[model samples]
Target: MKRLLSALLATAVLAGASLTARAETVDITMAAGHPPVFRWVKHANQTFIPAVNKALEGSGITVNWSEQYGGSIAKVGGVLEAVEEGLAEVGLVSSLFEAAKLAPQNVTYFTPFVSSNATAISELMDRLHEENAELRKSWEENNLEYLGAAIGIDDYLLMTTFPVNSLDDLKGKKIGAPGPAVNWLKGTGAIGVSGNLTTYYNEISTGVYDGVIVFATAAVPGKLYEVAPYVTKVGFGAQYAGGIAANKEWFDAQPEALQNALRRGGVAQREAYHKDLDQAITASLEAIRANGGTVTEVSPEFRMKWAAGMENVAKAWAAQLDGEGKPGSSVLSAYMDAMRKDGATPVRDWDKE
Candidate 1:
């Protein structure tokens, strides 16, 4: 029995030694074009990374995270290609920036004035992708595996150097909007110059553009009110234009445990993002006010007029998608129906006509 006890002690020592040694670690590189200032990247920093790390503890699995952000790996519009090309193993691909490639995934952006609750809009997107075959197909075709909703920003507002009391106030003004958002200005008579958050201040300050179609969450962080102090809350609807994605080939090769960890981390990131964003909206607006910026809301009458005046871009966009051999109308219908089911009353029924 003494010999048997000695052998058992030896085995125990070997197991302890194995435990003391560092576990095999998987290295994942997460990239985003935008800096951490934007909630898109901020959640990645605050939630995604830490959640995965904590979840994998003591599981014989560890991840070495290389965070490339603020244009470190790719520019704002280039994140999709970077992930596709394997430069980034995982990333937040900007659907808004890659609007042309992800056109069918942009149902909300097309149907503006839908709902102002950003979190609700994001949750609906999560449900659609899970329920719709074509939606999943669209992301698969891009060679990225969708992790979870990486919703960002908040309800869009009009920030201009001049106050806007009426639709006529926007006439002939060169306003900056990003990607597909340029269509939001149609029939409003605003010259929708393609622009993004990074340059809103400089562009508006230097007279390159009179104003920007921006979200309060970002406009305040960007200190846009300093340049364009007139903020008109038009409720152009909240948007979900990007999501956490993994390089398909790489993700498929990962162990199922790692894949699940990444997906769970993404979900945690989304929840933390909305919580952070909701709080930031009020705090940021207060800051904007303290900085001498004026905040005004467009009357319900004005909202109706704006919605009516704008051409039926949703249907037009759906037609364009159909021409491209996609189920744009179906996606539009699904999106609007989901919103209505959630008790949201949109000013215009984008899918009706």
Candidate 2:
């Protein structure tokens, strides 16, 4: 009877321990304004989520992800607010739309014709955020925490109904550009209309504009080539558009292991996203050619001339942010310095000018 009682008690203790070691299941709602068709959103769903899951194996923590995308929960300009309000725990917060709050992240947009290597640009921005507290401040101040993966756009190009062999071709033409990209047309003799990817196709087809400043990755998917058969590789440069981020309060409350796992996922996502992007850009350009679309690469002289003709929007942007006590000037200098250090020869040194 004594031995039986001891065995029974030991069994009960083991059962309690097993229950205590049971995995904790966390439900995390990940969101994005764009659909999974977009590379960034696709990688978030495919790469990031799986990386997190793999990292958490046998760690006594698991996540049940609730994915809301394609404006189901938040529109293009609303992801940041959604995460801030706790409507979603994590989101692909597009810095392009949140330029007012995330001014420094949009530094690449102001300094175009720099580098078209999306991977290098995205990794550089991630390194900057890791090393520079000033860049991270914008994310924190907005009640969010930026994860490592930077959603980068491929090189911006010119798509139009007519061929653009020279700057003279764009003279007096209506060109649609998104957000700060509109400034890219300054002194080019083209009228820049503020536009976006979602409406570019219909707007161009309906004669809302004759041309648009867009990227190849998006141009193929959006099928803008059908209407704008002439594609020009202007090399406006890859842009750091946004990143995967979590609500600050929620992220802060997570266990260190779980937090680290999410970060690992972000890093993995960045690699996968860029790999797919490189392939996509190639495939997109091929598709454009096969579909009767004309692709043109301007001469180096033409490119340089185009770059010189643009107004110094970077200086203006940096000055405005500096006036607001943000590290605008520093960010511009740091970004340009880093790009130069990485062997990128900008047609115009934005910070120096």
Candidate 3:
């Protein structure tokens, strides 16, 4: 009886040791600049993280997710810095807002009149990331690893109190724009107010600005329609990619299989994001109209006029980059070539072509 009890006790100890060995955990934190309700953050938390964990299931690895939305960790302008500093292991970065740091990659957003279709833009972005080694290196230099790109809502439109049927209608108006959009205000005679969708409502309400340059998906959730009530779709163009980025330091420390799982999860999340954006835009437009907002389709002639007026911004952007010794000219050229290849007839030379 003593011998049998000793054997059973030894077996129990071995079992406990094995269980402890298999219980390794990896905690990764992700952040987004928008509030929790914004589609980007909502989708990342609800759809992306879960898919990532599931992809790693049964691999003896577990992920602890920490999400910081509403600028809790990084505001829109500060995401890249936040990720690089290890404030969050992973984050949703806005290339548009980081043009100075991500000059070449972010230029895609400045190339107006490209296809407004999300799928095409998403595919183009994926191709760009694959084709441009330098572009990928840009992210790497910042101590971040690119996962996959997610498309923003369709082209920007003017949500204002006044109806803008033509370029002439915008003169002397106070237009709230984010980051690079300030340049968009140059030739139009409209006063440019730097603001984002998060503060758009308050800015408009407090008379800080008259209206905003924003997309529809955000309009509904932000309730901008309740205040401004006029959505003039300028068909400005589709916004190129923004996406999941992991701190390279943290990402490289993960096991190879786990890293692959995270990458696959990012691809899946991007696909889901595109799908959600389509539905969200439809719902947002409906919500806008329901709130007594006017949705008007700008005539092609008018759109052309608006596009023509903003022709100089590209050159200005390229020159600024050239001054910094970055590959501003080469990047801009590549993007324009790609745009034309994608059936876009840009109104002006984005890179003097």
Candidate 4:
């Protein structure tokens, strides 16, 4: 009778252990390079995170977000590495900033004057990711999984101390441009200064640059009006969708249902981002004007000149990619074709055929 009781007790302990294991929870952490006050963070907090949590409400998996904005965990340029090293389970990566790391993806940004419409640009990026396996593999090799992409503000404009009515007006001026945007500043004779959206405010105020290449939405929030108050919408073209990527290892460890929830969150975040951007553009313009800034719409003639000047950057970028053994030329051609199909007439041939 005692022996039988021992056996039953052992079985009960085993059952309890199994139950504990089944009740274990999965947790995830996400990081963004922008500050909490920035639109990226605002949207994530107000829209993205809540939507994701709601999607995963009964999934038994919990996501704990760690917002390391303003260069806390990773600087704007270091976000890719941050995720690769597992500093955070997921992160916001600016393809425009990490052009070399995300080559084919950044092509959309290199080719300026392609399309200023946010919707078209977002669709193009999503299609590019879906159609190209290699592009997806690039993220995998870096220990990350690309979830969803979100478009930044519309094409960049020149925010300067002086009014820029023509391409000639940019001559000899020092303009702060992010990595790919430097290519857009070529032939205008403007001295291109490497800068990021994070540093633009202080740099502009300290006279580190005469102006900055930025979008109206960012300018208003960054309070760029106090420094370079003249806003010029030069129709430079829209930026490709930035992405939310996760550490592949961390992602794989999650339950299948939890993984699906994160993806659904990504989709919701992308839609919310675009919608917010559209609304922010109008509000930003008004806010900038209200804050004592000047906004100007560049003429079509000047827009054409600006577009023509930056045409060769696309070819140069393609060659740079070819040298890297990636399908840069092919990607550029495909993207140009897609853009044209979407009603964007290219100012220059991407293939030169």
Task: Rate residue 31 of model 1 by lDDT.
Answer: 96
- Provide backbone clash counts, one per model: 0, 0, 0, 0
Model 1 ranges off by over 4 Å: 1-23
Best by lDDT: 2
lDDT of 2 by residue, 83-136 (tens): 998999999998888889899999999999999998999999999999999999
Candidate 2: where are CA atoms >4 Å away?
A: 1-23
The per-model lDDT (C-alpha) reads 0.87, 0.92, 0.79, 0.80
Error of 4 at 313 (Å): 1.1
| Tens digit of per-residue lDDT, candidate 3, span 52-141 | 888888887888788898899999878889999999998988877787677777775667766677666776776788788877887898
Tens-digit per-residue lDDT, 1-353, candidate 1: 99999999999999988764644678789999989998879889889999888878767788889999999999898998899889989999888888778887788888888888988888788778878888877778888888885585589999999999999999999999988889889889889999899889899999999999999888877999999999999889888788889989888987777888898898898888898888888888888899999999999998888888888888999999989998889899998999999989988998997
Q: After superposition, how far is residue 165 of candidate 3 from its true place, in Å?
A: 3.3
For each candidate in turn, the TM-score is: 0.92, 0.93, 0.89, 0.91
Score candidate 2 by lDDT: 0.92
lDDT of 1: 0.87
Cα TM-score of candidate 2: 0.93
Best by TM-score: 2
The CA-based lDDT of model 4 is what? Answer: 0.80
